[model samples]
Target: MTDLLETLIENREMVQPNHANMLEVAHGGNVMKWMDEVGAMSAMRFSGETCVTAQVNRMDFERPIPVGDTAYITAYVYDAGTSSVKVRLITEREDLRTREREKTTESYFVYVAIDDENRPTTVPKLTVDSETGERLRQDALEGEIDGNSDKS
Candidate 1:
């Protein structure tokens, strides 16, 4: 079994000019690339094998990360099949100076574990042993934690 906690991944990137559009906000493509990188890392962490993106669920760009700000990304494996891993990904726009953050985008990705030969391979079952892990899993399933719900 792979603990959900073990699959958690976090990353931050500065929105540079090259990664932004004419409006100075990050381009959706760059943000998506970051999400895919983090999601693949989490899936590989859970499966202990190379993982490839199989599918990406609805990805909505909720806001913008202007240049000079930070893109905060997080990904975790919330579920897995025999050969596929389900990862929840979220991106947040943050002003590093003030430490203010707002959600930018959220998406779910499916990754398939691959063997050395590039063939799909079976992956272990997922487990949530800690309260934090459980809460995160629930948050993924529920879209976002409710304001009234207990948070980890």
Candidate 2:
């Protein structure tokens, strides 16, 4: 079994000019790519195998991340099937100085573990043992979170 918290992944990317759009904000594609990467990492951690994104569920972009700000991405495995890991991903626009974060994007991804033969492989079961892990999992399932100043 894999602990939900153990599969958690956190990453930050400096929104550079190359990653920004004409409005001087991070491009939606770039943000989605980053979120996918982080989600894949979480899936791989939980599955212990190479994971491929099988589906990207509902995704919403609520705000824009400025070029100079930091794009903070986080992912954790909330559920799993025989060969699939369901990951909850969130992206926040963070000010490195003040450490304030605003959620800009949110999505849920399903990744399938693959074996060396390029076939879907079985993955470990997921377990939520801690309060934070359970809360995060519930939020992902219920979609109860919103755009607020507080960062989870």
Candidate 3:
């Protein structure tokens, strides 16, 4: 079984003027788009199949990234179901000139594997094989716990 964190993926996007809204910061839509892309990548890496976004649990914009900064997006599979992979999307802002990083946003996204016919397909079971993988699994468990708590 492949561990979720073993599928860690990272990508960076320069926040261009067009990516900003009226606030001169990266627009929410742009952030969402980046998150979706990274989340899908993580799912694809884990499932070894094409994956599509099924849902986004919640996206919280904890901070803003300016147009001149670089958006660093990181994603890793957190959990899996019969046909879905859960991933966490973390976005950070790095000052390109100064090399400083600050978290910008985070979200939980779920993706489903699809076959050639676009039908949902099963994914491989996940295993926590290393210390970091174990920690990521625990973090995913905490997210589950938080979700359950939010229901009540």
Candidate 4:
């Protein structure tokens, strides 16, 4: 059994001139790519197998990460089915020198565990045994609600 918190992953990338758009902020595509990578990592950790992205659900870009700022990405597996893991991803903009940070994006991604032959494989049961793990799950659920309500 894998605990949800055990699958949490955090990564940081600096937004350079090459990574920025004409607005001098990180490109939306680049941010999505980074989110996918981190989400896959979280799913793989929880499944203990290779994982491939199945869906990106309701990605919200709340703000932009300016050039020279760091993009802080955090992902964790909060749910799993027979062959799929659901990961919650959040991105924040940070100034390392000043240590100031603000969340800029969030999304829920799904990945399917795969076998050597690329067939879907069963994933371990996700456990939210710890307080932190439970809290993260709750937060993800709340985020989902918020994302969905915005469509109205």
**Model 2 accuracy (lDDT, Cα):** 0.90
Error of 4 at 72 (Å): 0.2
How well is each residue in 42-149 modelled by candidate 2, as lDDT tens digits?
Answer: 999999999999998877888999989999999999889999999888999999999999898888899999999989999998998999989988877776345332
Per-residue lDDT of candidate 1, residues 26-112 (tens digit) = 999999999999999999999999999999887878789999999999999998898999998989999999999888888889999
**Candidate of highest TM-score:** 4
- In candidate 2, list every pair of residues with a backbone clash: none
- After superposition, which runs of candidate 3 have C-alpha atoms over 4 Å from their true positions? 147-152
Clashes of 4: 0
Candidate 3 minimal-lDDT segment of 10 residues: 143-152
Q: Please rank every candidate by TM-score, starting with the best.
A: 4, 2, 1, 3
Error of 1 at 36 (Å): 0.2
Off by over 4 Å in 1: 144-152
Model 2 spans > 4 angstroms off: 144-152
> In candidate 4, what are the lDDT values of residues 56-145, reduced to their tens digit?
998889899999999999999988999999999999999999999888998999999999999999999988988978888988877776
TM-score of each: 0.92, 0.93, 0.92, 0.95
